[model samples]
Target: MPVVPPPVFALAAGIAQHLLAPDRPAGGARKLASAGIAVAALGLDASAVAAFRRHHTTVNPLDPARASSMVTGGAYRLTRNPMYVGMAGLLTAHAVRRGGWLTPLPAAAFVVLVDRLQIPAEEAAMEANFGEAYARYRARVSRWLPVRA
Candidate 1:
């Protein structure tokens, strides 16, 4: 079977969130905050994509071995998987706007699935290609969120 894309999982999670929460129309401030979060998350994803393009590397998640260079700058400096972070952020924004207790479940599930099933292989490929540089990057930066003391 062909591998399903991460964006597809993100989309399904969004749909599931909506079904669970049933988004209510937000007031002015809430609407603005949600939009802001979504735009920032999109920008994070865009910066990661731009970094890949700048390095002349492939952004294809399915084929991590094809990555020509390591991307440790831009949004990558924040999280090794900015695209996944952006998707989770978007889902979080949606959950905030929707305001149902169960709304966040799908987003949480999406993160867990990606972390468990997707990241290990990608990390292996990165280590195989970039070796110690990738190891250092992984050690310094986080797999998902950047948590600092």
Candidate 2:
């Protein structure tokens, strides 16, 4: 199966969800909250990228086999898939900023797609390459939410 990059899907779905809903301008507190969420999400995304860069591994999600290292430190210590988590966060912020019942639909769809399709394929590739070490990391880190390091 072809994998759609998580960020692209998040962006598309967020916009689609916004378009589907009635206009609801964000209030001052809501705007602040949304911006904070988005900023934090961007930080998570950047942390993942930084980890990849530090490891000199492939950052492209579509080409997992090209990965030179299985990153499991820093942001990886928090969640197994930090990049996807970050994208989900951003989607959530978009949903919050838009303010409608349908807003959350896009974020939900993103979760389903990434969890069911993207993460599985990436995990399998990592397992094929790293074996038990990868399994240990998987056991330690939560897939989506950051709970502990």
Candidate 3:
């Protein structure tokens, strides 16, 4: 649960937006992407704030000493890690906007880091804390990507 530096998120999101800027359509696609990013970012931010308010938020590895309640509101309805997912989406939209084929690297790297490192550690801690409930939730939601099936 180590928080990524805000600057890193900002830089990645900026790059992504830049990449996707070119493809930003004048109509539907642009509107949809804009709305999507806004909503996702809002949800993530809200959850993060809630986590902070509850004094359960941390960027370091999940420590029971710092553990808080499991948040399942707002964007958590769509994805478990809304903040991470939202950041990734911002990066992706940038890539799409820029129309840069190479724009996927940072986003992909972000995914790998979150999935392989942050998420697994968080999940383990959640499992230890919440037991079966966390497992069921994990079964229901995909770690980094939304499950289609």
Give the Cα lDDT of each candidate.
0.87, 0.86, 0.64
Choose the strongest candidate by TM-score. 2
* Tens digits of lDDT, candidate 1, 1-149: 11767788889999998898854777787678888989988998888888889999998878888989998988888899999999998998998787779989999998988888778878999999999999999999989999995
Name the lDDT of candidate 1: 0.87
TM-scores, one per candidate: 0.93, 0.94, 0.65
Candidate 3 lDDT (Cα, whole model)?
0.64
Clashes of each: 0, 0, 18
Per-residue CA lDDT of model 2 for 1-149, tens digit only, reads 34678878988998897797677568998799999999999999999999999999998888787778889899888888888888989988888888878888989999998888888888888988899999999898899885754
Q: What is the Cα-based TM-score of model 3?
A: 0.65
Worst 10-residue lDDT window, candidate 1: 1-10
Q: How big is the positional error of residue 78 in model 3, measured in Å on the Cα after superposition? A: 2.3
Error of 1 at 105 (Å): 0.8
Q: Which predicted model would earn the best lDDT?
A: 1
